[model samples]
Target: MAAASELRSDHALMLAVRDGELDALGELFERHHRPLFGFLYKLTSDRSAAEDITQVVFQRMLKYRHTYRDDGSFTAWMYHLARRCAADHFRRSSQAPHATDPAGLAEHADDRPHAGQHAASRDDHALLRTALSRLEHDDREVLLLARFQELSFAEVADILGCSVGAAKVRAHRALHALRDIYFRLQNPSRASSLE
Candidate 1:
């Protein structure tokens, strides 16, 4: 199982990456790329844009290696970088009338399966993505950092530059909002399974 895989802390991995260990970078990428891409793709609602931002975030990490602090967890630092990249990408795209075309949204939606062996709502994935996008940036960031990144509340607080109490509240609000949006999207009128 993926969870059963030997779990090395992000801090340990980054120290290696900082020392020019290419394999460490590969391991970090392999461990995080999917969930990070999913989180960004959902946040931006645009696959190509998310991909570009993710690459830029990683590149920026490499460029800013000298600035890394031993006192902080590398994962939190990387998450902060990604959150900034995603926020910037959203800001720019929102300013342009034709910033994100339908094709881009569709591509991002490709991250979700159209059908599945499990009976969970396939549409819920898309609905969840939409719900996540609707949240305030801080709320969304904390929730995604916790759920997708699997960061502890303390780590999320560090990445978000917020207090742990604030992170917990934000996560709660985001989850509540997600539940509301999910049920609304899967309203009983549209989904017989919801009843």
Candidate 2:
């Protein structure tokens, strides 16, 4: 038999929330808040803004509970709402998102016995963040949703309001763009030749 927690899928919990069992929304929040915060943090590169947006996401989830359909995965629905909240934040602030500090990225890195290895890893992460920030917003968003968040292509498509095939193509193109940027950042001398 499955564990009680395992048996209670996000869909089920969200259904309960839709049915007015308000505490179920707390369970949903607990399950999703961290990854949602990470997604927002990566998108905005501002901890304070990410924190505010994360809270607003859950609030919107609760307010818009009735709109969630049983046929859809809760994760997709949540991300869709989150994307809208992020867009709204950008519209209100009229600011482009920036790259997060390499030090902040280092917080997530594993400790290594070798200082050189650790420094190399940090540098790579910084380069990656800069590359990601340089990407067009749509490209960055596709990569974040598909790779960082580990959503299925189908889920990404739903969040993006496109077909799964379209989602896959976007992810592929975004990944290639990121790879090019990362390489250029690593080898600036070679960048002009490649272009």
Candidate 3:
């Protein structure tokens, strides 16, 4: 179950948006845009395309304003829109397949020579990003939605068109896969930093 505060925030803004208040939508955008953009950036590995897709997702939200109901969580509905937008982008890009290389994957292990923990942090982020990118689209989608978007399993399932139990199972598997990739790339050294 969502916290009362979270539900209150999302629900209140959604109600305002429904009432023809553009600032409500702007507030929602300001609150969610960064994490959502980061989620898309990690998923597609294309910042420009992610920006385009985010715009498309919000535009579609405007188009479907009448369909939004206070009974449902706004995050879940927005994620559903994101999932569709990502799928559409993937479908279009599938026509021009590019070879996956381990070269960029090496960046995961590349820690800059520095004195402080900043380089360590950079490597850790790179490792997570590379590992995240390595996941299958479905797995990546669930992981990002759960970790980055901070959504519940039920919300993730609704967005992905899967059952809550299935979403939970997938999230577990995706986390495991991400861990495996992290260890395999560099070693167990970074694992401690991750936590």
Candidate No. with top lDDT: 2
| Per-residue lDDT of model 1, residues 41-138, tens digit only | 75665577778988888887777766678788877887888888877876876741122332345556235553543556644555666556656666
TM-score of each: 0.74, 0.86, 0.77
Report the C-alpha lDDT of model 2 over 169-195, residue by residue, as the tens digit: 999999999998899879979756644
For model 3 the TM-score comes to: 0.77
Cα displacement (angstroms), candidate 2, residue 9, comes to 1.0
Report every candidate's CA lDDT.
0.70, 0.86, 0.74
Clash pairs detected, candidate 2: none
Best by TM-score: 2
Query: In candidate 3, which residue ranges exceed 4 Å CA deviation?
Result: 1-8, 95-116, 187-195
Q: What is the model-wide C-alpha lDDT for candidate 2?
A: 0.86
* Number of clashing residue pairs, candidate 1: 0
The local lDDT score (0 to 100) that residue 75 gets in candidate 1 is: 74
Candidate 2 at 118: error in angstroms? 4.3
